[model samples]
Target chain A: MTSILSGLESVKQALASQQFALSITQRNVANASNESYTREDAVFADVTASGGAAVSIQAYRDRFLDFSIGQEMQSLGKQQAQSSALSQIDSIFNENSGQGLQEAFSGFFNSFSSLSATPEDLTLRQQVLSKATALTSELHRLCAGMQRVQYSVNSSVPSTVDEINSITSKIAALNKQIPGETGSGNEFALRDERQKLLENLSSLIDTSYYETESGSITVTTGQGGLLVAGKDSYSLESSPLSGSGFQGVQLGGADITSTLRSGKLSGLIGARDQITGYLTSLDDLAATIAARVNQQHAAGSDLDGISGTDLFSYTTVSTGSNSGAARSISIAISDPRKVAAAGPSGGPGNNENANLLFAVKDEKLFTTSTETASQFYAHLIYRVGSDEQSAAEEITTQKSILAQLKNQRDGVSGVDMNEEAVNLIKYQKAYQAGARFATVLDTLSSDILNLIGA
Target chain B: MRVAQSETYRSFLGNLETLNERMNKLNSQVSSGKKLAQLKDSPASSAQLIGMRDQAAEIDQYQTNIDSGSYFLGMADSIFNEVNNLVTSIYAKGSQSASESVTADDRATIGTEIRSLRDQILALANSQVLGRYIFAGSRTSSAPFIVSGDTVSYQGDETANKISVDRGLEVQEGVPGSAAFNSIFSAVDSLLSNVSSNNMDGIQTALGQFASALSGLGIARGEIGANLGLLNNAKTNLGSQETSLKAQQSQVEDANMAEAVTGLSQVQTALQTAMTAGGSILQQRNLFDILG
Candidate 1:
């Protein structure tokens, strides 16, 4: 009698295990479209010497693949951010629309040449002033655009740091909950949530994380700086880079801007430097142009019979300092009658001065080196275009890599509806078979009992 | 390997975005007829394109200069022809009046004709074009020749004002009044005085003076003719140069319409194919479809 009861207990435990398996399959089929949900499996084990069963459900996830995704996602984030910023710079000039610095500059110089052709043509003198205004305004527009790009990068740093801190704290909270749930019950859903969080964190900044025995995760920077240890998360702060409004990232009161290798934060930093570098070049070009043009202009005589003075006024005349000369430059000589065209006050129709200014277009006056103004401007455009093009291509390549990594991860963790359906039917059939076996055992025992009684 | 539905969707979406961007780029090329809509499309080419454009613009300015130079030369050319004609008339009348057969009254009558020719030559010396005295050299605002009683004086400077026709090449706007007709006027004045006095020997000597003056005028005319020729050749050369520069600029900037249209359709076909192929995978139904 004791043996029969033990056998019935074993059969009942097996039926419960099959029911659990069916429920797991049902969960998988229901969550097939959920990107955050990983497929679960019902693991069965014999608990008694008489073959009694017990069940544990677990999620199938590859830790190495998660680490690869974390690393790959960081790069994709960086390239994406860099590309977005560079393209913003590209659009500001509008090259094809003829709304660019190049056209303005050439127009201004060409106007000078036109004046040289008919030095006494009052209409052409006013045209010179118009072209000068256009060129100066375009320069200011470009300078302002560069400032805006820098300001944008500087402004984004704080928000990005705040986002990082928030994400890190959430990861810490997830870290606290995952171990507790894993120790006492099924942690499949919690693990899925934690994985999603890690991927999110990776996009903001490069990170490394590992799972402990209790299923808790320890997070750190890619370079091994502790970010989150168990349930404690470190926070990042922003500090002024200089007396200027520009801010740099700080972790534990030490700037980690240079240490940041991959992610949007690093991309923003790189882009800011790129914009500043371009700003310096523009200032240099402006300074050299102003210096040379003013010199030639001052050597000639104007319609007012005064010897030429500086044609362009600016905050600074220094070329190498790059101290915002482009933004500051404007026409120093306002009176159209004050425009110098005579060589040494020779006569009104001489036109030697305007010719000198027109010659500035092809002269090596834009740099201390031998590059002409047009050449320098062309070089600047080429540099900017190259930077943008490279960034975009890098983003594409990084994105493809990230996608490949994601696909690899999804292969192991993703649920197939057809597969889940088969598992559901399989478990259901096994449940039915177990019930039939129990019924047969009951019938045999009852028949034997009747015989004994007779 | 198992295809994750989310990943497939994301990949298809990315591919579609890429195709769409390409389509938009080709559309821009077709619409604007420019291949380089942005600098980053091709950096080196963009820089080269701008450089060539600058060169073309500079060439245009030079062309304008050439046109103005040609007009100035034309003015100088007509003035020199007038001076040459005056020199020829002075020589013919002086030689006929110097012969012994001429009567006193006839010589007096020839004196008046000669004086009229002298006045005409003086006026020609002070010729102005477009309100500017072309013979005044750089002093273009005022006439260079002055008449006091019977004698003419040249007040103009000796400098022949030059205008640039090309880079480093210059042509004089007009010859100085002193250089072209100064000697001719004095010779004509002397012949008028000789005819008035009825002195045949003085008249013969004045005829020789008229011959030399005409020769001097002929030399100045030749120089003016040569300068005019230079201006013509410069204009023709500039036109041909402008033609070549424009062609190069077009090559750098303009898109080949035929190739662009063909490529546009090809890209469209490729996009359609990609969509169809991606469609087949994403359209695979769940188990419920088969069960139903």
Candidate 2:
């Protein structure tokens, strides 16, 4: 009777184990579409002394794939950010539309050529003033547009830091909970959630991380700024720079803006600097143009026979710095008669000075007198285009690499509906067999009872 | 390797996304007729396009200069011819008056004609075009020739107002009033006195002076003619240069419609095939469906 009861107990245990296996299959099927979910299996084992089955949950994942994907995500994030910023800048320098600084510049110079044709024509003098004003306005527009791009890019840094801090804090919480949930059936869920957070954090900032034996992760910035350690996470801060008022990143009160070499944050920083450099070049161009035109204009005489005054006026940021030259450039003289279209032997018809002013168009005025103003501006546009192109190309390459890695990872841990369906049937059949065995055991026990009836 | 359900879906979506991107690019190209919509599409080509545009603009300016230069020279050339004709008429009258058979009354009648011719020459010298004296050199706002007593004095300076007609080339727009009319005015003044006083030797000397003055006017007119020729040549050269630059610019920026349309259709067909394949694959029965 003890042996029959023991056989019944073993069958009951077998039924429970098979049901648990079916439940695991059900869980896999339910989460088949969840991108963050890892497939789980009920690993069955027999109880050595008790002669019954025991089960444990096993989650499928490749640690190496996770690490590789995280690294690739950082690159993808950086390229995407830079590409977006550069394309915005590319639109501002849209010379292809024929309504750019190039047109203004050529128009301004060509007006002088026209004035040289008929210096006595008051109408042509007015045309020169109008064209000069237009050129100055164009410079102002371009400079302002570039500054707006920089401001917008800089403004996003704080929100990005907030997002990174949020992710790190959640990861820290997961780190604390993962150890307690280890070896339990719920641990796999915590691990998968933690991995998703880590990937999210890595795309915002460049980070290196490793999982410890205790199932917790320690994350640090690429330049050794501690972000997450066990159950504690350090937060990043954004603050304005001293002179420029641009935002800079900080880690624990230390400026770490330069240390961030890759990721979205680093990409924004690089693009900001690139735009600032371009602004400086534009300022230099503007200042050089103003100075050269003013010099030539001063050497000539106007319609009233007075010596020429400055044709253009601009305010410099400081001594020897043309920081705001482009933004501040404006025509100094409003009177059309002030346009010096005459030589030192001044008359209403002398056009030697006007000819000289027109010659400025083809002069090598920038880049150590190697390129004309137009050429210099064209080069600036080319630089922006090339930068945007490279970033776009890098994004494509990085996306393919990430896709390949993700595919390999999905092969390792992603759910297979067919496999889950088959497991469902197999476990159901085993449970049915276990139930039938229990029925047979019951019949035997009853027969034994009848044989011993009084 | 085991293909997960999500993996097949992901790859199919990725392929569809790629095809859609190609289709979008081809559509933009076909619609805009410009292969380079943005500078980022091709930086080198964009830079070259800008350069070509600059060259084209420069050529346009040079052509305008040529036109303006031609007008100034053409006006001056015709005026010089008229002045030469007047001077020749006076010289013919002076030669006839210098002969011994001429009576005082005849000399006096010839004097009136010569004075009228001189007055006509003075009007021609002060000829204004568009409210500016054409012969005033750099002082074009006022008449360059001023009548003083019996002779005309040149008020205009010796500056030859030059306009740029080509790259590194300048052509004088007008000669100074002094160079064009000073000698002719002086010779005409002496011939008028000689005819009114009936002095044959003085009339003969004034006729010799008139011939030399006519030659001087001829030289000035010749300079203006040469300038017009230069401007015409520049205009022809610049026109052809502008055409070639525009052609190159078109090559750099304009899209090939045939290629773009062909690519658009090919991408459309590929996209249709991919969508159909994905649809069919997604609809295929799995193990769960078979069990149901």
Candidate 3:
């Protein structure tokens, strides 16, 4: 009782199924070169124990690998930020190039030493003044350089927060669209786009995401702070600090800067701390120089028979405050004759004070109480250099690890063009066979009808 | 695990980046010829270099002080010979007058000559070198002697002026005018009076003063010789110290040229190898040939 027309209907269903499968193979072949696009496969379901087909596209994803990549990205962001800032510090303190304060300090102290030879020589006295002025100017330049670095770090934080908000917004949009687009021919591409966005988001702020039961993804930032819950996204907020204050990221109206585990935000915070620490050390150097030099200068007499006058004064002159000492340091002596070159006897021929100033170069009078000014400054430079070197090494190391993780992800999801090409041919032949069978069944139905009519 | 096309490119780029970084550092070292181009290159060495440089500067200053001190001391030593000669001539004139074989006219003529010689000694004692009175102690701006008919007043303080020649060693800058010529002036006064009076006893008495004055001057010269010796020794010590410190600083700072050049070529080779590998891989058409 099975007619030729019903047989033709079964052949037509087979042709439609083959056509759908061919289209999927063609899509895979077309998108094999796309890095963000994952390889897709058709899922077929049976109906009533017969060869009835229902196909859906499946995009590949491994939750654990994505989490690992996110964590690694955060570490990479921090290392990169720290490396760049430290390199700037290294260049600022490069001694052999004569870009740093070492030469300036040596010139200043050496001028003092030379002043001893002919304490009455106007040229030598002028040399001392000129060198002192140059040293103070160099100190100012150094302080400004530190400020510029800190400014770069502080300014970057707000932009990073903005980046986080933008990424979260995109993730929310993708989440809303993902469920609606599933089984609508755009599901695989949507998921691919979402994954790419997540990678970017992870670089900006450490994050973890999970698939919901509704087939949507929810993104959370550092310490499980909500970023995107299904279709809803939370924005990262920022506010200007009071008086040279840097804006920090806020989540749910609470500041999350200190809690940021690792990311661009964390790297920037670490950079700010480094800048502050270095600034403090620089200030200590400047303060100590001013205080020690002033103590000796004030106790001695100049060529003009005047005593009790400071040669270098910054802030309180005697007390070396930690902040702004370098910027504040200036030559306090007005007349060149006011440069003290006399001892306790205070005779014009006495070059005892000049000798004392020269001796200051070798004095272990720093806070560390074991290093001179020159030694301390050199120590500062070496500390910053080593930090930069470590940062550079870390970046190379982290990049390698990130690359390996990415390879693992690629193994699971990357498309093979050669395999897709072969699949393209096989699907095309099946479609052709199904179409040829449908035509044969139509021919058979027509022949039976024609015979009955005769 | 399968390497994605992006991962391959990233790996190539990272390797190239590392090679380029090494190349840049090696280039800096080679061109600058400094292992310590920056303070951060090696902090301890940089700090030590600074200390070494400071020591070198200190040594140079010591040398300057020593040279300056030696110049004045040498001036004093040469002038002391003139004083000794004048003192010897006065002693000869005093002994000749005390012999009693001499007439009054002869004694008078000798007294006038002795007075003239005494005036010359005072002039020599007040000698100014380099625009400052050499024997005037710390009050170097003026002459140290004021002559009045029979007596010479000593205006210069007897303080031993000193110039620092070493970190802890200070050498006498110049002989004090009072110490050098005050007794000589008294001796000359005694010889002139005895020769004028034609008294053999007084002339013999003045001869003792001349001998003592001469001996005192010899001792002052001896001190000058000691200081000059000290300055020379200090100069030698400072020179050697400066050389040693400079060597230390160079060790901390200057790069080994051979090592830097070798490193540069090695890094360059690595760079070239990485680039060639990356380029070859990029040019590969595995999928294209298979599909075609």
Per-candidate DockQ vs. reference: 0.46, 0.74, 0.39
In model 2, state the lDDT of residue A73.
Answer: 89
RMSD of each: 3.3, 1.6, 3.7
Predicted candidate 1 versus true structure: per-residue lDDT over B17-89, tens digit per residue? 8888888888999999998877788888778866777776667776677677667667666766876786788
lDDT of 2 by residue, A221-339 (tens): 99988999999999999999887788999999999998888889998888898899889989998999999999999999999889999999999989799989999999999999999
The sequence of per-residue lDDT tens digits that candidate 1 reaches over residues A59-161 is 8788888888888888877877787888888888666455588788888888877776556556777888888888889889998998898889878988998
Specify the highest-lDDT model's number.
2
lDDT of 3 by residue, A252-351 (tens): 8887877887778887878787877887788888888878889998888887667848778777334434677887888887678778876654555556
Interface RMSD of each: 2.3, 1.2, 3.2
Q: Write one digit per residue (lDDT tens) for candidate 2, span B1-292.
A: 5778788888898899889988998899999999997888998888777677777777888888888888777877888888888888888888888878888888888888888888889999998887788888888888888887668988877777788767798878867878868999999989887788787888888888876798899888888888888888888888888888888888999989999999999999999999999999988778999896
Check candidate 3 and list the clashing pairs. Answer: none
Where model 1 places Cα greater than 4 Å from the true spot, the runs are A47-53, A97-99, A183-186, A212-214, A222-224, A317-320, A366-368, A448-454, B90-133, B146-178, B181-221, B286-288
TM-score of each: 0.90, 0.98, 0.88
